[model samples]
Target: METNSMEAIVLEAPGPPEALQLRELPIPVPAPGQVLIRVKAFGLNRSELHTRLGLAEGVTFPRVPGIEATGVVAAAPAGEFAPGQQVMAMMGGMGRTFDGGYAQYTCVPAGQVIPFRSDLDWAVLGAVPETLQTAYGSLTEALDVRPGQTLLIRGGTSSVGMTAAVLAKRLGITVLATTRNEAKAAALKGIGVDHVLIDDGAVAERVREIFPDGVDNALELVGVPTLPDTLRAVRKHGVVCFSGMLSNEWIVKDFYPIGYLPRGVRLAAYGGDANDLPQAVLQEFLDAVAAGEAVVPLDRTYRLDQIAQAHADMEANRAAGKLVVLP
Candidate 1:
C-alpha cells in the first residue's frame, strides 16, 4: 500500500542541525522478524543531539536521529501484529544501528514493536516511550520509590525529570524537584512536583534544611558534577539514582574512597532500553495519560523540514518540554 518513496529527514553527514536534509526515501519493508511502521511522529532526545555531533563513537554517517516513534504497523509478522495496529518503537537500535523513524516509514525489529491500544494522539505516544520508560525504570529499578518517601529530582526541568516527578507523586511519594532557574519553580509545581528547589550548587544543603533527616531517595538527571551533592542529600541507607548526564559531565574525576560514600548509602543507575521498558510500566503510564492522571508535557511539533530547528531548540535548552516531529 505504499508509494514508490516517502519523505524523510536524512542525516547525510555529522555536523550542526543543518546536517539534516529532507530526502525522498523508498518506503521501507519489513524483513523476517521485522515490522514496518508508517511513522506519524517521533520524539527528539538529547542523545540524538550527541549522535548528531558524532559524540556517539563508532556511529557512521548517513544515519537517522530519532530514537523512538509512534504510528501504525504497515507490515508485521503473522501472529505478531496486523497491519494498521497502533504501536511504538524505542531504544532498540532504531535510530542508532539502522535507519529510524525520521521518515514516513521505518522498519523496526519485531520484538521492539510494542502494541498499545489507546486513544492517545500520535504526539503523546511519541512523547511517552523514552521519557516515561526511562523515568519509570529508574524510579522502580534504581530508586524503588515508595509511599511516604521523600525524594529529590536533580535536573527536574528536563522531560525525564518531570516524568519522574509525576510518577513519584502519583505513587504517594513526596517529590522535591529542582531547577537551576528559580523562575521554573512555579512551572514545576504545576506539574505535580510537591516542592521545587533551586539547584544553586548547594542542593545537598538545601535538602538538609527541608528534611533535616535527609531524603529517602534522589534521582540524579544531571551527571557527576551534581551527583556528589545528590548523594550527600540522601540519608544513611538511602538510594541515589544516576540516570542521565544533562550537565555534559560523564566522569567523576575524583573517585573518593569507598568510605567517602555515606555509610550504607546505595548508589544505583538505570539506562533505558527495550528490555528496561516493561509492558506493565508502559501500560501504567498510558493509562495515567488516558485518565489525565499524568501530564505529558509536549512542547511543540515540527515538520521534517523543521528538523534543524528542533535540534537547535533542544541543544540550546529552549525546549521547555517534550518536542515531537510530525511527518
Candidate 2:
C-alpha cells in the first residue's frame, strides 16, 4: 500500500494556544510492538494544555497534544493488533512523548491499547479512559476508599472529580464534592453525589457540617491552596490522595493543624506516573464502563480543527464534563 500524508494539529512552538497549527504531516508507520490507529475521537486533558504552554517539563515542540482516544486499528506489526479492531488508549504520555491522537492517525504501543466492547460509542469511549483511570487509581489504589466512608473531591464537577464521585457512589461511599460554580451543584447531586459545596472561604465550614467529625478520605485535585483545607477536612488517620493541580502548583503557606498528625493521617500523591499502576487503573475503568457502573458525561464535542476553542473553554473553566475532539 502506498503511504500518504495526514492532517495533524502540531505545536510548532511551546508558547500559547495559537502555537498549535493544523498541518499536513507524513503519516507515521507503526514500529515493533506498536499499532497505527485511525483515530475516530479524542479527549482533552489539562496536562495537554500545560504541555502546550511550556509548563510541563521535558515536552518536545511540534508535538501532538491528546492523551486519550478511541479508534480502529489501521495497521499493526505481526503478532500485535489486527486491523479494524476498535480500541481505547489513554495515558502512557501519548501526546507528550510520542505522536498522539490529535491527528488523522496515531502510532501508539499495542500494550497501551485495549479493545472496546462492540456496543460502545467511539466518542464516549474516547472520553472515558483517561480521567476514569486517574480517578480509579487515586481512589482505589491510593486512598483505598471504602463503603461507609465519606470522600471529598476538591474539583467535584471536573472530569476526574465527577468520575471519582461516580465510582465512590457505586462503591456505596458518600461523596462530598467542591466546586466553585453553584450552578453545577444540582447536576452533581443528580449524579448521586451526596453533597456539593461551592469552593469559597466558607468551604471548610460547610464540609465540617456535612461530615461532622471530618471525611474519611479526600481526593485533592487542586493543589497547594486547597492542600491545607484537605488536611483539615480529613478525619484523624484518614487518607488524602493528592492528584491534579487545576488551579496552581505553589505550596500552601498557611499554618495547618499539625497537632492532628499524631492521629495517623496520611497524605499520598497519585497519577503523573503512567506505568504499571496506570495500566491496572485503565483496565478497571474499562471493566466498570463495560458493566454500566460508570459513565463519562461529555460536556462538549469539537472537531479537530477547533482545538484552540477547546483549550480556551477548558482554561476558562467553562466545561463541566469531559471535552471531546472528533476526527
Which residue pairs in model 2 clash with each other? Answer: none
Model 2 lDDT per residue over 1-327, tens place:
666998899987777677778888898988888888899888888888888877877677679877867888999886577789887776676888877889889988877887654456667777776777788789878998889889999988888898889888989998999889898887688778988888984466788887778889999987777777787888888998889888857355554657533256788878743343354555566677778777776788988888888888888888888898888
Candidate 1 on 151-265: residue-level lDDT in tens? 9999898889888888888889999988988777777888888878888888899899989979999999889888888889999999999998887667777678485577778
Worst 10 residues of 2 by lDDT: 272-281
Model 1: residues with Cα > 4 Å off, grouped in runs:
257-260
* lDDT of model 2 at position 228: 73
lDDT for each of the candidates?
0.84, 0.80
In terms of TM-score, which candidate is strongest?
1
* lDDT comparing candidate 1 with the true structure: 0.84
